[model samples]
Target: MLTNINFSARQALSGVISFSTCTIMVLLALAFSTSAYATAVKQAPYEPDVAAYRTALFLANMTPVPWSQINDAWADPISNTTDSISGFYALAKRPGGSALVEQIKQALAGKDTQALYAVTTRVMATALLEELSRAHNGLEDGSAKAALLRATALYRAFEDGIRFLDRDGYRSTGLAWLDVNSAAGSSGVLGAGTLETDPEKFGAALSIISDYIATNYAPETFTARLEFNAAPENIAASGASIHLAFTLPPGGTIDDQDPFPMLVLNFEEGHGIDEADLPLVAYGDMLFDSPVIFGEVAQNLGVSCSTCHNRSDINRNFFIPGVSHQPGAADVDGGFFNPLFNDHRSDSLDTPSLRGIRLTGPYGRDGRFGSLRFFTRNVIVNEFGGAEPTPFMLDAILAYMREFDFLPNSKITTDGNLTDEASDAARRGEILFNTEYKNMNGQSCATCHDPSANFLDRRAHDIGTEPPAYKGALAQAFDTPTLLSTASSGPYFHDGSQPTLGAVVNWFDTRFSLGLSKDQLADLTEYVETVGGADEPYQAFDDVDTKFRLAFDELTTFATTLNILIPMKDAKHALIMINTVAPDLAADASTMKNLDAKPDVYRLAGLLNSVASHIKKDDWDAAQKSWNEFKTLQDAVAEGMF
Candidate 1:
């Protein structure tokens, strides 16, 4: 685990602290000239640049660590460090060694602090993935696979959080502590939380997450593990499935801070997913966080599902004009511009919460897509301009999505009723929300936004909010979003025109001519902001980590299988592979520089855009040219551009 300390490395000694880390090669030539050059001993499995970074970290720590002395010592079998960092760093001398070392050196000298942090984060992220690949033999590996995958997810979350906070832009604000919202805080829900000074809060933050993963999930396998069977997700619903809960560790409780917090994903009610098992959920989670999929092409631009919708929720930091209306809302179709994918509608949809989405549907603001599968495919390929996702990849994406859920706010019931613990205003709000009493004109809020059904009637409404000349589907009839998640995902409505609950209520009250006192309106807004409750907690699976590890393996396996089949000659597959591989390769840009591919990245993107035109016109030759250019770009990746 790499630490993100603002302080320089600890002074074990001033002696070794200033020794040049770049002296390994020169020292090796002089000290070991007479002795035979010892064969490179890889301490562990690694990709080329990973090996180089690992070595750089090791040598950077040890003052005056001469490669020649290490080489001479390693010549003796008794001096073997075959399973250690020093041994593994030695692999940098192999075919791709020098190049990766050079890349690391640049990062070491680079002026961009955010980029440097991203590089170390990438190393830890890849390291867990490598371990998972080795440990996951098959489905039968069970706990072994789940443990590894969970570790991978934690590492991914660590990497993602660091990228989220820093890569965009972070600075040492002149404050000891800055007021902030918790990750769980959304809209107006859970709004009060605190963070220390930026350096104190951020420094080594990645290491903290990484270490938790190491301590809990570092083991390759479990000895004896618990398993569970699916039960009725709810006694009220017949077909829905329950989350396979786990037995808690000795007094251990799931916390809100857990990135992949143990959510009781009762996805059985939805027919969208085939299995609601832990492993499947974990597999799905990994794919969503991975830039190797939809977020690939935008890797250099810092776009990932995690980059935008962090932890499957809203990204509070993203703010590109047209692409992002504010912090959390974004225009999905703004990712790329091309004829085939663009409808030229220019619709700006509010970013919906993927959490608890298994039950909330009539997908999208237009409620156009009948199934999540179609919605997912369209978002990646058509909206984000990701390469065409294969059917398997789509399924994996949906699997991850089905498990999303909102945390228990505990302030209100599922029906938007105030709990005994609710504030006086919230209680008054609950009364107004559930009341069928109409104004003199016979119009009632509950008639349209039904309380029993998560405050939505499963139909679109004008509500005086529609733009008469809007250019998208059902142009005037936008879907009614759930009031339950209103606290976490707003600026409201299709266009995110309203910034707060009070604003939304004000618009509705005026449109409906509901004459209300200021006190009444405040109470009503409070309930709407605080509504929505949690389902039953999971209490079954004792080995969630193992199950998750298995899922991670399955996800990786699927990606590998699908990606390897990409032939640059096939325009379609080539496009998909480009989206998948480019971002994936770019993920390590922190320490690994793809000098040759860097320029081609943009060229390939332009070529990809031109390809749609050729394909649409059935111009085989033009398409061929585009594909060939793509191939040239890909070749840089194959040759280890980083």
Candidate 2:
């Protein structure tokens, strides 16, 4: 049961959100604003049975609003809400559901948080599973059983919705969710995914809901997801701490947002603290969670890096006005289609997974930039009209992004190691990959991609992956992305033209005329999806200033790639970090730590700051004035400076 939340979105937002100035660090505090990507709509499946089952499934999975939104959600003003509350009651009335609805009603009516939590988590989930068991045995609608089983998953999702695990999907405090395998004692999706098949234990554990919920909800006992964060610094060193000023309590306050005053938590790595460079990582975490960093358009709609890239979800359901091709896809370059923004040509690209990004390079579908720093600044400036990143902020983000790893998979023999115990099918697929069948225009998959290069040749190729109407550069050629963790970032290709690895095989077969049989295609798909992410971190840069240069250059490249004014506020910070590390080098990559050059270096930074400030106000004359002075100083300090 795939759960999708559907709600109406404000339609008139795109026109208003196109341009405005905001810097990444400037808006770090606006982390928990309204969600911009709330399900704007639910499209029909065009089949009654499927739609009914889906509806039942979605209701079962809905979770509580963030604690801050509770009052607006449940207060008496519009208290007749029938969504989750009504859905639970309806499910309780289903066959074999028992009197769980009454228990739930009492819990809600009494405002009994403890009773409500238990009843909602245990009884309702249990009752639904029992009904689902009956459905599976053909005593009831099997579809309803199928739908009811999804309830546990929804309950699980509900818990997740409450926690909203932000620090790379794991938290040092609060409830840790259990995987619970399946009812048959198999590690699978919610309801153990086997309540019907293994009735003896599976059905019983669910039947008593309390039996299983007790183990799952035990406050102090649980497996910590994503390994623990780095420990705090030594006791003598200022007693490591971080400002948890933006935090919402585990379950949120009763009536309103807590406005967490002086809420400080230990500087634990998993709690927005990085043991390696605690301050840098904390700053990055705040920036990542901040929605105010984006232009007015994204802010008004409540979008931010975390909005799309958070622990709970990557927001595959996100949609924006005139920018969404479908639920999971966004047209990043609105200027290409909308004259009001910065009229250009249409260039819709797929969102890449941020995890394991260090291994997955040249950025974007075209492989736009070569590294994370480059890609990071480019996204800020172009996608959000953000102020340039300072050097420190860039490094801070660098530390944070380094924390992301590939989704765990066992197929790859070792982390980032392409070598695997090649199964017979994979071997055959490798043969097909290297073989230049005459029918394929003498093209071989291995010619440009193979395991030796992480299945990416670090180059672009044309396999004609374009629709008849697409005239963009990506339609003909696209950068070869890693097959590492290919399972998650799908519908494949620059435009998300293929939904699965098999679709890629099919496209090669039809377009390149490979004429491969079904068996061959299946073998190829097996190899691609089975690959895993690197087990250890991939460190790309050493000097913070040198990294700043690469990142700044990447942002510059984004401007040439397309015509638009991207307000990157990062450079001001970069300028400072550069001076701290290499004073005489301006932002260019030259080794010089001379104290004599500090004044000139800072002067250049001040000029650039003025440029950023002027750009924000749409004072192009003043912006260009300061920009030219900064550029002159940049060149005078060293060559290759921007």
Candidate 3:
């Protein structure tokens, strides 16, 4: 059975939380304090469904509450349709859920944040009571068990708040839930041996939970409010550490970002690439992860190139409140991140993946820059307001990024034709995709997205996508995006509006009046999914800790480049290497499991700091001495640490 966890906030929050009293207090303090983005709205609603709750919480926890976006989120359930919640039954089926929807609509109409929050929590409390009553009254064991499970999901909405407000109540309530699940028992699979429900046991367990909710969460009793803080804090900052206190623009979250923090490098051999063989690549890897290359706020916040382009691919979860219209998209030139780069327009574009970047550019969404180096330099200096990158820095970063390869796909061959592995529907769709139509001005899908050239013509077109800010404004054209691996990369298009391949096909059909039949549309969708699909689109690291170790090892390997630089007496690039490695070592060491070995890790970092000091003074001998010491210490502890 599906739980209300799994890639959700609860799961993402698990690793970061220490469970200590001080930890809880600190987190709560951050939560309640006026966030950099949050406005006058003191609290967000306690929503029942996890998805709805996340969307609601995201909107409420903005600088000036995005009332428009919040209304759009609510607009889904306000209509007469019911949707699935964690593969359970429809949303309205939950106790008092329908009434809550209506209340949410009314609150949205009235523009009352407090009333919205109150109604949401009150309904959740009442719904829990109703479910408990249904479970007790139900004759069937299976039906009773279902009710208990639904009630458990509802209870989770208040768990964090309850943990904050009342510890004893939290403990008791948690135990009650476990007991109730045990009492309801399980129906064995394949109708083999079923454990019948115990009415006496069930009543005892149910009462503990029911009484707590009635006393604490009843409409009149419930007074607490929920406020979420998603801003990325400088976790690396410690007293005397290289990092400084920094804050995010808005809607920055480290929660979901933590799972896949490790930089994934692909090579011809796949995985194992010696840093010694590719010194520039190694240095570039460190530069990509290092925030020192960026300006003040970005450096302090630890925002680097890797933050948006995780593993040389799109960081789809990257979001900012005012700057982003949706997740996986941000207005890089917006006033929020850097006022100097603001284009004075709210034109938020989807963050395109950098995989196969060397092949895909003429860079930028509009294909504005012909040179990749120029584009990258502009990103550093113009977009994020970082200082002009040094020649070596640019060269190394370019070398690292050029190594990024597209995910391998078996369904499509070199020329982008569907292989034997592709479905018949996909093959049929390919014909339609290649066929030119008069409706599109004698053009076809293949006109822009040429199958022979990685599904792109290396050109930009208006395609009716750009919404002009003014009546006389010219429509902006976007570069033809490659279709490879787009199956996993969505919402599609420049603005991330189309959510699926089918949606994209439907959009084109309507926009150009193609008069494609429903079957033809389905075939076209299948073709795109086939071409875009990959066997393994993402890194296959087992867990977050494993990825953390990999990242630590990579940083250490990258640091070895200092060996060559120190001997050559190259102070500039050597200092860049030192600065990047030192802060990274300090930050990564905190997450290392071998706590006893951490001191040695810090000592190694201190050596880098020493080398940096010598480099600043241009004392090559002293820098080499510190380097030798660092290498000796690293050789001894590198195998055991992290």
Maximum-TM-score candidate:
3
**Stretches of model 2 off by over 4 angstroms after superposition:** 1-32, 35-277, 310-314, 335-341, 371-374, 414-423, 439-441, 467-475, 532-642
Cα RMSD, each candidate: 25.7, 20.9, 11.8
What local distance difference test score does each model get?
0.44, 0.44, 0.68
Among all windows of 10 consecutive residues in model 2, the one with the lowest summed lDDT is 227-236
Per-residue alpha-carbon lDDT of candidate 3 for residues 80-113, written as tens digits (9 for 90 to 100): 1123232112346666667766765677777655
Error of 3 at 428 (Å): 1.9
Rank by lDDT (best first): 3, 1, 2
Compose the digit string of candidate 1's lDDT tens values, residues 1-642: 234311222221221333332223322232222111011122323332333333333222222222332232222121112233432354344335444444444555563333333343343444554444333332233343344344443233233222222222112111210211121112343655432233233223333443433432232321221111111112102221111111111111111111222333445333444342443354455456544454322432324465555555554444433234345555565323212343434454656656667666778886777788888877777666567777756776687787666666677666656678778887788777656545524646667677677677777766557766846655477677777655655667777788888998887678766777899999989877767433322223234333323332332333332222223234444344334433332222222233454554445445655654575576767766765676665555444432
Query: Whole-model lDDT, candidate 2?
Result: 0.44
1 versus 2: better TM-score goes to: 1
lDDT of 2 by residue, 576-599 (tens): 322222211233222224446556
* Whole-model alpha-carbon lDDT for candidate 1: 0.44
Candidate with best lDDT: 3
